[model samples]
Target: MFRRTFWFTTGVATGVWATTKVNRKLKQLTPENLAVAAANKAIEAGGRLRDRAVDFALEVRDNMARREAELGDALGLNAPVDRALPPPRGYAVIENRNSPKYVEGPGQKSTYTTYPYNRNEDH
Candidate 1:
């Protein structure tokens, strides 16, 4: 009698646990939950793809620069030439069209002139 009672209790407990587990899974399988899960997975995949692309681009750029340097050395063009940066264009210069410096006389040509300016041409 005791053995039969123990088996009956164990069977009831197992059935209850299985039913709860199945119901929980069914709730998660709803359309709304499924869509959310799919979107989250897609976003994760996109992020990974973007990271890979950026890494690939950086690698390609680094290799290209190195190869160019090698080619420059072979061509005897690797010597460091004069590297000078131009003066910055300030807001004052850009806005001051009436300034004497900006006034384009026959001799003084504006840098933005459509035609080339030659000092020898005036002589």
Candidate 2:
């Protein structure tokens, strides 16, 4: 009787332990848990992409501004005209199709205007 009781108790303990482990595994494998994980990952990726795009746009704007300033200096253009007064000492004012163009003179503007170089030139 004693041996039978001990065997029965051992069997019950083993069954309970196995059942608990299976339940935990099932919880982990549920569709809800997997979907939540995928959504979190997608949000993280989208945030990173947005940050990169913003940074790229800012960099492009800065470079364009710098290039514009350099071109103005190279063309010997005076500072952009003030609507209130005539252009400064060396600057000539020009009317632009889309925007008002201010410069030293038409002569300098045409002189410095660059044409596209040979496109197929051998390196």
Candidate 3:
């Protein structure tokens, strides 16, 4: 009787363990798990892109300052003179008469006819 009870308890414990292991494996193969993995990968990629952009901006700033200093030296000016120069300006919009017009062109006439047609009547 003692041996039978022990075997019964052991069998129950083994069955529970097997069931838990199968459930865990199935959960790992679920769509929700896959989506979570994909999202994590995307976030990692985005972080890398953000870091590269910051590095690129810093590089551009360093290069521009170096070039300005070189130009100042070649022009017989001191480094401090380059620092006194104003920051570069953005594009400017010019309003000139020769600019293209959105209106009708020369010698072109626009005619509008009424919805109801009356061939016998003249306007």
Q: Where does candidate 2 stray beyond 4 Å?
A: 1-25, 78-123
Tens digit of lDDT per residue, candidate 1, span 1-123? 999999999999999999999999998999999999999999999999999999999999999999999999999899888789988986542435643334466776553433365554323
Q: How good is model 3 by TM-score?
A: 0.46
Candidates in order have lDDT scores of: 0.82, 0.77, 0.78
Clashes of 1: 0
lDDT of 3 by residue, 1-123 (tens): 999999999999999999999999999889999899899999999999999999999999999999998998999786354447697899775533332332344686533333465664332
- The ten-residue window of minimal lDDT in model 1 covers 92-101
For candidate 1, report its TM-score.
0.61
Report the lDDT of model 1 for residue 6: 100
CA RMSD per model (angstroms): 15.9, 19.7, 22.0
Query: RMSD of candidate 3 to the true fold?
Result: 22.0
Residue-by-residue lDDT tens digits, candidate 2, 1-123: 999999999999999999999999898789998898899999999999999999999999999999998998999775777579766688565544332222356556522333367453322
Clashes of 2: 2
Report the C-alpha displacement of residue 63, candidate 3, in angstroms. 2.8
